[model samples]
Target: MEHEESNRSEFLVFPLSQVRKEGYKVTRKAPPSATDWSRRATRTQRGILDGSLGHYKGKAVPKGGCSAFAAQTLMKGTKPHRIRIEGMSITHDASATPDGIIDTVLSVMRYSTAVKSDSDERVKGVKGKWSSCMRKAGFQYASPQAAANDSRWSKGNVPTRLETSVAVADMQCKKKVRYLDTLVDVQSEYERNAIAEQSATLASLQSDAKVWLSNAKDEVNKQPATKRD
Candidate 1:
């Protein structure tokens, strides 16, 4: 390898495939196993997926999911946040030219493939309510997403009359029926509960993370300075 990394520097900056052969092997960890971390992380992530079952799914309480809705909607149409961590360090997320570009392109393509999933199915229950609401307003669609992407309404340069009507109706339903608010509530609540339940495991995961960092430092620092370049 042209370069090697070490835990002394708080990073694992070399190519991943050569890590064990040339880098420190992270063999020590706290009580929780790696499998536990993976399982808990997956459970936590599920609440954030864009589906009906995600979010806290809070019951209607007059303001149903107002906090969750605000959390999501307040940032719409804005430039992305540019916050940097003060102490946290990562070697894997560097925005180096071709790698960064390839990573971004792959991310977008992966999202596009979700077109293979039926939006109505992913957000089924809430979508049913939304469709019913729209039907009452003389619009027919399985989900707002489907209405927005309807091939029948894409003939013009801008929105066609039918497209505009469906979009307006969809928005109205989103607002009037508390569909989005409720869904967000459920998703957020689920995440909160999952985090609370996995408290001990999560703490152990942090210790495991440090072990990884230490191993990387050990591996790279042990190598000669000439080999690092």
Candidate 2:
């Protein structure tokens, strides 16, 4: 905390009371219990570092053909089948085979742990550089994740001055070391390799899913839409 933060004054002068007032206004306009502004703000800061903020702004959500269509239609309450299980209600076409296929696909997707490990290995050098940069900036963080998850910030309704200073240093160090870009490149390479290795299995799954969806479409077309009071 000895490093002179050039912008520390700016954060200190910002009114926490104003932030609380604005948060109250925002929540009144949003659905009850739907928003957590403090957490959202912190996540946005992380997103900027990871480069996922606004990543899909101009992109269309990829449609999964009949699967996507059936999901969207059912979500809109056009689903004809309704059942209760153990006093809890759920809506899904029990006759559809997509559930089994989805479960199988999810089980196959568990290679994420390996992908993360490989990505960490590729960034070891860059991470060391980032640590050195933070040290020079007067922060003692071992990693960006450590700085972002500092326990001190959890006590405040909004980010404190020290947290803001650390976050700025974290981003600056990441930029200096090109940490995020290199991490992304490493992760994408491993992911591509994983997909290539699983190509045959994935292809078989896709083909089976298409056949099931086609049958589901015929069944859906024959059923009358459910009426609600």
Give all candidates' CA lDDT scores: 0.44, 0.53
Positional deviation of residue 65's Cα in model 2 after best superposition, in angstroms? 26
Q: Compose the digit string of candidate 1's lDDT tens values, residues 35-112.
A: 664456554344343232334546332222333343233222222222212222212221112223234433433333
Worst 10 residues of 2 by lDDT: 5-14
RMSD of 2: 16.5
Residue ranges of candidate 2 with Cα displaced over 4 Å: 1-120, 225-229
Predicted structure with the largest TM-score when compared to the true one: 2
For candidate 2, what is the lDDT? 0.53
The residue-by-residue lDDT of candidate 2 on 57-116, one tens digit each, is: 464333443335455443342232433322333333533335644564444443553346
Cα TM-score per model? 0.35, 0.52
